[model samples]
Target: MASGNRPVLTVTGLKKSYRSAGEDIAVLRGVNLAVAAGESVALTGESGSGKSTLLHLIAGLDAADVGEIILDGVSLSELGDAGRAALRRDRLGLVFQQFNLIPSLTVADNLTFQSRIARRHDPKWQEELVERLGLARLLKRYPEQLSGGQQQRVAIGRALAPKPLLLLADEPTGNLDEDTADEVLALARDLVARTGCGFLLVTHSARLAATLDRQINLHAGVIA
Candidate 1:
């Protein structure tokens, strides 16, 4: 744990299970962790170690069967479905491997979409992110017009536009080649630092994990 630091995220005895067929599959078992503001933590695990499930729970997209997830001092269990959604929109930024951009919207529109929805739209910040992400030249181009790497860059720009308190990325560079992945991760790290937000990156690449401030490995759903 980092002393003298304000925690942006705190998880205590987090657990989750799923009903698969006739059996209950326990995914996470008593996992506890904390992430400090402006810190970057890399989470690595085997495919079925429940990495994505843990991320979903932390993101408020899914409920945990047991344990507490506190983000910025608010407990996720205390928030109703709508409240969680609002919290996510207002205080959290997420980037997925799929690069979920609006196909019909231009790059610029896609970039500022979430911030606009969250009512935290800052034109100056958005402009800076666009320039930093190299999306300034492709503002008018649709997602379909961009390559995979380009779309991912747009996705990163979109997540960063809101200046959220925490950013969650699930294998954000999974769709890119090694060289491009490194580039994108570097850009993400730089932006996260400039924004002064905490970051949790779920990845399998040891090389990539080494670049972060700390690495947390999940074994059978528990931090090892």
Candidate 2:
């Protein structure tokens, strides 16, 4: 892990609810958490435990009903739509269970897409990611041309290409086999350490959760 004691992300007094059938369904209630630079955390929760809702709020995809999220010292509540969008583009790395690679682009292009658009592209760093992710020989292939594991690797590389301050993954390996999931996650953790970025992963696998530096379970709208 890189040297740093400062937290890359922090959540305080977070609360959210949704109205359903004339009733307000509470999701997250006063949830507080923090992820320090170079630290990896796993969030485990049953379905409807609000894991994805919390992530959406943190990523600025949706607004929290109450409380705040601080990303690299910038408060999410303070940012406008444009600001949030810009932050997401430039400072946050996000990966989902689905390997959302561009089908039209080759592996090299897919890997560099976000960095290039954000104007944060670093040739050296990009090369290092390609090498570390074992994607060098597959650079010429497109997303459909690769296997599930390979495509996921490319997705991870693309997310980390710009060296974001925080990485949020929602069941990133949900579609892969156990062995492949472990391998992919190992690569992700190694890269997170290399970048000194805070990592927050949501997974259902208790075994996978155990590999993280810390594990927290969400239950009944709060961290349990």
Candidate 3:
């Protein structure tokens, strides 16, 4: 783990709401959290508990109605749409339950896609990711040619290739079986540590949540 006291992510009094059938629905209210460098934090919440909403807000995919999100010393509210998009591309790594690997690209190309676009590709680091993720042998294979776990591993490698300041994953292992979920998550945690990047993982499985360095629950639109 990288030795640093400063947090890679900080959320303060974060709030968001939406209109539903003419009624206002609050998803997150006064939610405050932080993730330090090299730390892995698990976010567990019941369905519709705003877990995905918070993640979307953090990733700049959606805007928060109120509150503040500071990522790697930059505030989300300060950036415009294009700036936020650039930040997401350059400073944040995201993974979802679906293995969104490019079907036409080989594993090698898929792994380096994000980094290359971000202009932060490091050959040595990419090589290390290939070796660490056990993707060396599958480099020439396409996504369709790999198993679910293998494809997820490639997704993870793609996310980490740029060494972003923080990694946000939403139900990243939801589509996998127990053993495969555990294996993929273990690789993610190890790689997050290796990169010294803060990790915030949203998971429904309490068993999986307990494996992280810290765990937090969201309930009734607040951190409970």
lDDT of 2 by residue, 112-210 (tens): 999998899999999999999999999999999999999999999999999999999999999999999999999999999999888999999999999
Task: List RMSD in Å for every model shown.
Answer: 0.8, 1.6, 1.5
* Span of ten consecutive residues with least summed lDDT in model 1: 1-10
Q: Looking at model 3, which ten-residue stretch has the lowest summed lDDT?
A: 1-10
Model 1 shows how many backbone clashes?
0
For residues 1-224, could you state the per-residue lDDT of candidate 1 as single tens digits?
Answer: 45677999999999999999999999999999999988999999999999999999999999998999999999999999999999999999999999999998999899989999999999999988988888878999999999888999999889888899999999999999999999899999999999988999999999999999999999998999
lDDT computed for candidate 2: 0.94
TM value for model 3: 0.97
* Model 2, runs deviating above 4 Å: 1-4
Candidate number that wins on TM-score, 1 or 2: 1
Question: In candidate 3, what are the lDDT values of residues 54-147, reduced to their tens digit?
Answer: 9999999999999999998899999999999999999999999998998999999999999999999999999999999999899999999999
